[model samples]
Target chain A: TQLLEQSPQFLSIQEGENLTVYCNSSSVFSSLQWYRQEPGEGPVLLVTVVTGGEVKKLKRLTFQFGDARKDSSLHITAAQTGDTGLYLCAVPASGGSYIPTFGRGTSLIVHP
Target chain B: DAGITQSPRHKVTETGTPVTLRCHQTENHRYMYWYRQDPGHGLRLIHYSYGVKDTDKGEVSDGYSVSRSKTEDFLLTLESATSSQTSVYFCAISARDRVRNEQFFGPGTRLTVL
Candidate 1:
């Protein structure tokens, strides 16, 4: 089983603050993804990083995949109240496996 | 919205009682999944179906069972509810793309076992 560990399980900040969340693993993945979830709703995908050392940006959010493919990160610049939510990192299982390994999630609270 | 939905958005049942949850999708997606979300546990896959009448176990499949009799419906059943099973359940649909794979989720179902 692949284990994914996320840091700063809980975070709180005021508006205009920039924050970064990290996801690390001992196992390598072919692809890594980041997702944000609101309460009472299922998680929605933010970005998918397929290659190592790849970066993708969505508006004010930036995502990076580690060169080892065992880690990933999400950085929010000038975060707003709407940025408050749980962030997750996932890796799809390898070798004909379709199940994605999920992180416990980082609960972020951005106050206006 | 992915046209995915879960029935009985909220349910409360006692221990040793059988409970079934339904997942319906209109997208005709080839893959359907069942997951449970708990604080500090994120989402754990319980079961998934790759095609009609074909299903497989996930990381946390104990005490739970799933069936996919058709292309659009997947069902999850708890033989006898347990307090450990109290958590928010989510159903997701994904259509395998040649380029990349993405999953679309439903609102979710909150089940509390007493």
Candidate 2:
């Protein structure tokens, strides 16, 4: 199991504040994926980064993959109440078994 | 939003009893998986299937069994429900081989064992 460690288990910030969440792992990954999950619902895929030093943006959110492909980060610009939710980073198992292993997750709460 | 549905969105059962959770999908995807969500545990895989009647265990497969008699329906069964087994269960599917595809998850089912 490739264990991904996500930092800042919990975060609370006022609206309009900027924040960044980090996911780090000692194991190398071929690809990494980010997801956001609201309470009482399943997680929704935010983005997938496959290349080292890659950056993908989804409007107010930016995702970056480490040049070593062992870490990733998510930055949210001008956070809003709608941005509040649990964020998770995942990577598939090695040896061609694409079963994902997820991090514990970071719970973000944006206060309006 | 994945055209997936899990039955008994909420269920309460007692220990030492059998409980089954159902996952149904309309997309006709080839892969299906069952996972459990717990605090500080993220989502742990319980089992997965590659095709009809083909299944395999996952990281947290103890005390749990799954069956997929049809392509669109996957069933998870607990031979003996326990308080430790109480948690939110999610079903996910990948249209292609999981190695090259993204998984779509169902809403989830919350189960309580007393």
lDDT string for model 1 (A28-99, tens) is 877887889987788998988988899999999999999988899999999999998999887775667777
Candidate 1 per-residue lDDT, tens place, B1-114, comes to 679999989999999999999999999999999999988677989999999999999889999999999999999999999999999999988885533467888889999999
Identify the runs in model 2 with alpha carbons over 4 angstroms from their true place.
Answer: B96-100
**Predicted complexes: DockQ each:** 0.54, 0.56
Per-candidate clashes, comma-separated:
0, 0
Candidate 1 Cα outliers beyond 4 Å, as residue runs: B97-100
Model 2 docking category: medium
What is candidate 2's DockQ?
0.56
- True-vs-predicted CA distance for residue A52, candidate 1, Å: 2.2
Model 2 over residues B4-110: C-alpha lDDT tens digits? 99998999999999999999999999889999999978899999998899899999999999999999999999999999999999999887443435678899999
lDDT value, residue A99 of candidate 2: 73
lDDT, candidates in the order shown = 0.90, 0.91
Interface RMSD of each: 2.1, 2.1
